[model samples]
Target: MKYAVIRFPGSNCDWDMYYVLRDQLKVEPIFVDYRETNLPIDVVAVIVPGGFSYGDYLRSGAIARFAPIMEDIKKFAEAGNPVLGVCNGFQILTEAHLLPGGLRKNQHLEFICQQQDLFVQNNQTTFSNQFKPGEKVMMPVAHGDGNYYCDDVTLQQLRTHNQIVLTYSKNPNGSVADIAGIVNEQGNVMGMMPHPERASELVLGGTDGLRLFQSVVTRQLQK
Candidate 1:
């Protein structure tokens, strides 16, 4: 299936995501600029790649969410189509209210760049269906505001509903409950603070991230 990788001016990982989909996964990825509001009809998935949009001014994704395309992204996600947001993309999703809670500054208040181990918490979602829950995989994370936080009530609901998709095997950014990723209740839209595209190739040190993309593409074909 075709995917659209949204591109804001500051987006750095757009090409990485594109290369993974096109060269590695053999799927077409259309690079849609931030000003565009309509998605290609052939696009079965959307990707908001990692980047410091607007120089991460005001806050990460606070400015990026105002891009003309985000409203459409939200609508596309609400229609139960797959949308994967990585790093700053995760910040955008939270800013746009596409997902719950917020990503605060790392508890240590520093930008962290490191490879981390994450356990699949829920494999039922389109993003992680290829793996079994509790499986550990390595992915790279780079962000200053990767610490996920929410009120106790919302946290309880997320846990009770099994919405948490991935968790740090060992907390790295001080994220709440070691959450590395999560999906909306509908299970279509997924957001993670880690850069899966960066880990999709063995040359990049690991190929574990590829399973997330393959899971969604395979599931769509099954439908």
Candidate 2:
């Protein structure tokens, strides 16, 4: 199967994501430029990797959200295809309204980069089926604006629908309810602050993130 990795002007981790999908997952990964208006027809999944897109101008993902390819992405997502967004990609998803809530400056107003432990709150979704509920996995988080915020009602809705998928073992960026990752109501799209690609190899410290990619591949194969 094929996956699309969207590359923006300042996307530094696109290759990292490509490595995970192409080498580790043994899947074809197509790099879709932000300027492109469509994804390859054969792609079964889309990955919006982490980076400082558009130099993070006007806010983390405010500018990148308007990239030409996002319209097609939105449509692809609406059709029940899987889309995974990490860090800056997560911010872009929220900006595009593909997901709810916004990422704000870290509570301490400083950039943070470290290994973080996250609890799997819901493993029934496509992005996390390899994990057991309440499992703790370690992944690296590097961001200056990773604090997630949403209104009270939204939080309640998220809880009600089991949309909150991951929570920090110890609140890292002061994200509400310790949210480290979340899925959309339809459960096909997921957004998270941690860099799973960075943790997918044993040399990188652990392989906790590998299962996430495996889960996606398994889901596709089953279909």
Each candidate structure's TM-score, on Cα atoms with residue i matched to residue i, is: 0.98, 0.99
Poorly placed runs, candidate 1 (over 4 Å):
none
**Model 2: per-residue lDDT, tens digit, 59-153?**
99999999999999999999999999999999999999999999999999999999999999999999999999999999999999999999999
Which prediction has the highest TM-score against the true structure? 2
Candidate 2 regions exceeding 4 Å error are none
Q: Kindly give the stretch of ten consecutive residues in candidate 2 with the minimal lDDT sum.
A: 165-174
**Alpha-carbon lDDT, every model:** 0.91, 0.95
Which candidate number would show the highest lDDT if scored against the true structure? 2
Per-residue C-alpha lDDT of model 1 across residues 1-223, encoded as one tens digit per residue? 7899999989999999999999988988899989997887888999999989889999999999889999888889999999999999999999999999988999899899999999999999899989987899999999999999988999999999899999999897788888999999888988999888988988999989999999988898889
- Please report the TM-score between candidate 1 and the true structure: 0.98
